[model samples]
Target: MSNTTGAERLRKRAQATALAVILSVAATSSLPSTNEGSKDMQNTGTTSPNASENLTDRQQAIVPIAAFAATGDIANLNTSLDHGLDAGITVTEAKEILVQVYAYAGFPRSLNALAELMKVLDMRKQRGIQDAAGRLPGSPIPTGDALLAAGTANQTRLSGGPVKGALLEFAPAIDVYLKTHLFGDIFERDNLDWQSRELATVSMLSALSGVDSQLQAHMRISMNVGLTANQLRQLGQVLADRVDGNVARRAQEALDRQLAIAPGP
Candidate 1:
């Protein structure tokens, strides 16, 4: 057979396989229905999944960060990069992932996670590994009302609600911050926009052990960013097929959540 035909057949098979796996995972899991439900569930654990089964190159490349973010597993996060870096991932890209998740995950995880990334950097330098410690391509910083206005728009669009003057289940202050800080401050950074950032967040959270609700919410938000149902299904399948065992469950949970909330076609 011709190489092009082989490649075409492979792509179709991959998509089909991904769909089947995603459907299976979606069958048994569930996600919370309200913003209050999300607030009540702030699980922060980390897990490692085996990516040896049948992951593509793109999925494999992103598995580490997603797994680490999902479970907040510092040790595995470190180990994941050890593999990625050795396999030729640049330090800069790794840093960007960690830094970006701070808005979605939180300061504590983000701080600890970034610290871990820095540790990897220090080790890389000592061993002369030559991974990048370079800065982002465009270090754009948001400022003033321009920042606030954009954040407001981003938050409203992402949550499918007003997102302003909303009260938090735990801390009332955080509701404002979500609209202002997460959507406004950190999100306005140009290096990564709302869509790509949310994609990474959904993927990472889905691979986590306990953040199923958050994963589901982001999966919804992910759709708001123009991500199709099939695209999300592929993401879940990619994580399940390629990432660790725990992530398969997480990905499945996320898929179930999406299926529940997805408007009927």
Candidate 2:
């Protein structure tokens, strides 16, 4: 009896010790390690300082659409158009973006892109997808001298001041055309905002080679029109994800150059 009692006591003690060890292990596992705790603190504090400024779905849709249109990549443009429309870009807004492509990518590319848009719309309609037709220009475009004045004002505002240079001096007619037609005629259309226009311009410029200077200039103009550097960085990411890496690299480099010259406040 004494031996049996002793053995029973030993068994109970061993079971109790086992239970205690299991509880201790569970408690230790529940709490984070020291390194893990520090990492958690850093992540919670500074993982994304500007997360709110990231580009919207609609804005990101514009990057690939514009880049594909500029490079005459009709197949990718088709996909981007479908995505953009699905992302809440109205029919008129899409049209306006393609129309603006001519100013940078030339008439043929613009025309082809517009035709592709038409096809996309038709196909979507057949599939019972009713896309919204966005609004038109709310005001009339200026004419003659008024047009020139308006364009000049716009150029000054967009360029951040009166634009004077040897290029303008040597090509006086081009200057007049730029002020009168491109700025006045195209920019005066209030349906699309300047920020969107600059987004399209930057994307279009980024896709084309031998236009590094223009791309960099538009990067500055993009900032002047209220696009944040974080948003532009997001643009580059969109290009990389949806468009092409080379295109994104060009855009990022242009943005970097602009930021180096004029860091945002």
Candidate 3:
């Protein structure tokens, strides 16, 4: 065996300890109990009082689009976008999901998916299909400090509290961006409810590789926001049927991990 320095072993142990603490905090704090989330779920308008019922047509339409977009399957994304429009998913709602996609999938994929959407819409118009140009958020978006404050609040609620972890502490800017931009600006926008947004997020994360921790976190967030475990399982089936089996497997693994940690209703 090669000699390993005492300092190197200590450093490795410290890193492992930090990761465990972060994962513990994330799992415990990011998800509210079902009873705790009920009121918020009702207010969001994304689900019925019984969230376990089958997802609505619009919700189903969004699942594959989100998965394909996150995985950079442009051709499949294009087909799903057209199907989404045909299934009564308004342009505004679809646009909101794509914008949210950028937060997880990054700017390049998000931008490309959006561009694909525009092309889909233009082609549909040529084919004489009039996809609904959905309404924008009626309220004005907050600016400057107010925007930051609103985002912080939104982030707290979604995460079940103010998020704190080793990685966030290492790069506080990322936490700020998550709160101010991802949770605050994008989440504040109307048309899509928090539940649907979380659903899209969870679906996207499930398709992406090597982000099991984030995927697991989103699974909790999905539940906290209103999706039932049964609904998420159905989403896995949707991914298998509509997208890739591997993506579905990834989603199932994340969900399983979440369930093992926190058995929910």
Residue range 155-229, candidate 3, lDDT tens digits = 656555555666888877766676666655665665566666766877887787877777777776676666888
Q: Summarize candidate 2's per-residue lDDT along 133-209 as a digit string, tens digits.
A: 97766657889999898777766666556665555577677678777777677767766666667678888888988
lDDT by residue for model 1 (1-265), tens: 6989867865653343323222211111111111232212211111122233343343355556645754588887887777766654456556656766555466677778878878887887898777745334343445677666756665544555444221244455654555456666554443333434554676666654455556666666655545566666666665665566666667666667666645466
lDDT of 2 at 115: 100
Best candidate (score: lDDT):
2
lDDT of each: 0.53, 0.72, 0.70
List the lowest-lDDT window of 10 residues for candidate 1: 25-34
Could you tell me the lDDT of residue 212 within candidate 2? 75
Q: Which candidate model has the greater TM-score, 1 or 2?
A: 2
Which residue ranges in model 3 land beyond 4 Å of their true spot? Answer: 1-52, 263-265
In model 2, which range of ten residues has the least summed lDDT?
25-34
Roughly what TM-score does model 3 have, to 2 decimal places?
0.80
Query: How displaced is residue 202 in candidate 1, in Å?
Result: 1.8
Model 3 weakest 10-residue run by lDDT: 25-34
